[model samples]
Target: MASVKTTTLPGGIINRPGSTIDYKTGTWRVKRPVVNLDKCIGCLICWIYCPEPAIIKRDDGKIDFDYDYCKGCGICSLECPTKAIRIVEE
Candidate 1:
């Protein structure tokens, strides 16, 4: 019989918070997202769907991308209802 290892911490517990900010994950991105500001319509659908802190909402009610942390997952482009965001090869 094999002995099972036990953990003092609870399952699905987060030991570290905000750890993603410590690492820049965009270096390996094969595709990048580009935004067409004219077609954006200020919908913010991309910003809401982005998994990373790569979407920036400007004070003027517009949005921009932070490439340093954006992994180019294309989720933003897919979620944009106005087709304002497009994915291009890096």
Candidate 2:
């Protein structure tokens, strides 16, 4: 097996009436992965397998991910043990 890596920087103009936040990753908004913190156990499994390393653990022990860098591949949602994540078509 081989590994594929991707990196992207966020770009956009300030609030100017409907200015689009340009995310270079082509799959932007392709799928929406919602994390259910209510069910999340802070296991960090989703964080480890996230190909883009988008998941970030806050100092308060909450988890969040950067959507701008997410490819929406659904791997994280699938790998979550507690069913803490789900992917919806966008």
Task: Report the number of the highest-TM-score candidate.
Answer: 1
For model 1, residues 3-69, the per-residue Cα lDDT tens digits are 2224435875647776456567777678999988888887788888888869999787878999988
How accurate locally, in lDDT, is each candidate?
0.81, 0.73
Model 2 earns a TM-score of: 0.66
Q: List the residue pairs that clash in candidate 2.
A: none
Off by over 4 Å in 1: 1-19
| Per-model root-mean-square deviation over C-alphas | 8.0, 11.0
Per-residue CA lDDT of candidate 2, range 1-90, in tens? 012224323563343543233444525558868888898888888889988777888776757878767778887889999998988887
Find the number of clashing residue pairs for candidate 2: 0
User: Cα miss at 20, model 1 (Å)?
Assistant: 3.8
Candidate 2: which stretches are off by over 4 Å? Answer: 1-23, 26-29
Error of 1 at 53 (Å): 2.2
